[model samples]
Target: MKKLQILAGLYLLCSSSTWAVEPVVSAANIQEIRLSLDSVWVVLGGILVFFMQAGFALIESGSVRSKNTINVLMKNYMDACLGGLVFWLIGFGLMFGVNQTGWIGTSYFAPNEMDGWHWNLLFFQMMFAATATTIASGAMAERIHFVAYIVSAAVVSGLIYPIFGAWAWGSLFDGEGWLKALGFIDFAGSTVVHSIGGWVALAGIIVLGPRLGRFGRNGQVHYLAGHNLPLVALGGFILWLAWFGFNAASTVKAEVSIGRIALNTHLAACASAVVYMVYTLIRGKAILMRGTINASLGGLVAITAGCATMSPLFAVMSGAFAGILVSILPVLMEKLRLDDVVDAVTVHGFCGAWGTLAAGLFFEGRMFNSEIIAVQILGIMAAFIWGFGVAFIVFKVLDKVLGGLRVSKQHEQRGLDYTEHAELSYPEFQHDVTFETDDMTKRH
Candidate 1:
């Protein structure tokens, strides 16, 4: 009897202790679980976006001349590193800080916020800031001074990109900005990021002028072929993969709707590729690899603003239009005597505007109305004017202060790889390399 009582007492004690220390995980705790999941999803999404920096680097290096490959690679590296650091120090504060009379941000500079969700948001936005500045790299490639490029990258990430971002998405989580108050809807920054990058690229190119051999006498346009098509295609695929995170992660929550966002993004890209390829075939022309890649990217840009707002079918429609837009805009720019080295203006700028407008046309739960369309147009035009105008001033000022943005004739002929970095991308093939300078007889 004594042994039985002792054993029963010990069992009861242990059972009571277990019940007291551990709560049951059930439906009652779902809210907390959901919050944790949301944070995890957001962080993962941010990580995926960071991988796009590699994609940009590959695309840019492959698209330029072989002799300038190293220069392009270095510029891209600086864009992510310097841009991310500057964004963390000042850009994040200006973008997501407390509003100052609905104009700009005033707080969060050098942030020490420890909230997991807030940090996740910061990471995601930092990637976006880096991307915006990097877009200018391809446009100004081959001839720009490294120091000047760094300065321009800093300016865009620290001030121009963030301030505009504040006006549109500063209140993304639960705040309000002037544009948001005006009912502007940019689901994932088509107008805010890509269009801004595009406009800025245009400004820099205009200031820098055409590459030496790009235009011939009598207004003839010469085509400068990219060094590596395989790398370009590979880069495109990587960007396409990254975009799933870009569009889906914008939800900022782990929910079923994320599936829809990702699906829409995929559909849009596919439709765009098909349309571009068909358009080329119908015109009795061989489908160009670079054009198809750019068209796919244009489709991705177009769907970014409306991915969450439109049906999958509408996504297809939007992407088809973007494919057509990217195709024609390049020709239009060339006709104006503007040489955009990689067609960033058309793929990002023109398509970005169209994507924003397409959202107004197809958004669910919002009645098709002139007011919404007008607001969308207003935002697009605002981005174009501000992005282009400010970038122009910045470049022109840098040109004067830095003793001109383009390199000398001698350096240009020798290639930026040798002139700017004093390194060759392919040193083993030195004999095959061509130098256009009169000093060719001189020893290296």
Candidate 2:
């Protein structure tokens, strides 16, 4: 009887202890857990997107000549550092601040007080601002003065990108964007990010002019092949992996829908790559590695706006069209005497517009709603005007105020790595060669 009583007492004590510690499954508890999970997901996505800076560095460095490799890498590095700082100081507020007018954000500049969710959102968006600024880096590679490039990056991150972003994504906070109010759906910023970058790149290249010797006096185009194709390929793969987070994380939730978004993103990229490869083969041209890599990126950009809303079949269709566009737009750019070193204008600018259109064209169950497409078109036009027109004026002013945007012709012939940075990417290979007075000898 005594043993039985002792055992019963112990069991009751344990039960009472468990009851005391057990979590109550209340709505508040569940909501808190949901918030935590979503915050974590957004942070992870931001980290992935941040890694894209390395991808850009590799791609831009490999695309330029050996002499200019270090210069390209430096620009990409500064873009992340400087661009992130400016976005935090000014851009974030202008993009996500509370406003009644909706033209721009009126608060949140250099935000100091915010909850965990706001911090996570700012971190994620800072990566996007860096990305938009870096797009102009590759297009202006080899010739742009380092100081000028840095200034341009700051302006874009702090002003141009944020203002346009406010007009489209302002509702992310307390303000409502005019475009968003019109039912313009950019699930992941095809126009707001990529197209804006592309437009800035277009403006930059127009002001900088083509690299010397890129076009002969007779108007024949000379191809300046990338020094390291393998690096370009590797960079392409990195960007490909990063894009999943780029598109899916825009949902800002840890939900089942991320699976579908990721699947659509993958399908679009693969379809576009295959289509570009096949097109090259059918045309009897050698399979160009860079073209195919860019084709995949074009598709990724195209699907970003619609990844959340698009079905797999339509994703493929959008990617296929992007492949075609990527194939032809480079040729068109060359014909126009506009020199884009990495074809950033076509891959990001034109393809981003197409992707924005695809979002409306393939909206599930509402395919090709005229009103939605019209809204999308309006958004596209606004991005172009704001992004390109403003950037053009900025670059032109910078060009004159800074003395020149391009390096001296003498410095250009000697390679920017030596003239700009006093460093050489392949110094060991140049021990036997001597730079002549005329600077005519090409540094291999």
Point to the candidate with the largest TM-score. Answer: 2
lDDT of 2 at 441: 36
TM-score for each of the candidates: 0.91, 0.93
* C-alpha lDDT of candidate 2 relative to the true structure: 0.91
* Shift of residue 147 alpha carbon in model 2, Å: 0.5
* lDDT digits (tens) for residues 74-114 of candidate 1: 99898889999999999998888887456678888888865
- RMSD in Å for all candidates: 4.4, 3.8
Model 2 misplacement above 4 A: 1-24, 431-444
What is the overall TM-score of model 2 with all chains considered together?
0.93
lDDT of 1 at 107: 82
Candidate 1: segments with Cα more than 4 A from true spot:
1-23, 26-29, 172-175, 431-444
lDDT of 1: 0.86
Best by lDDT: 2
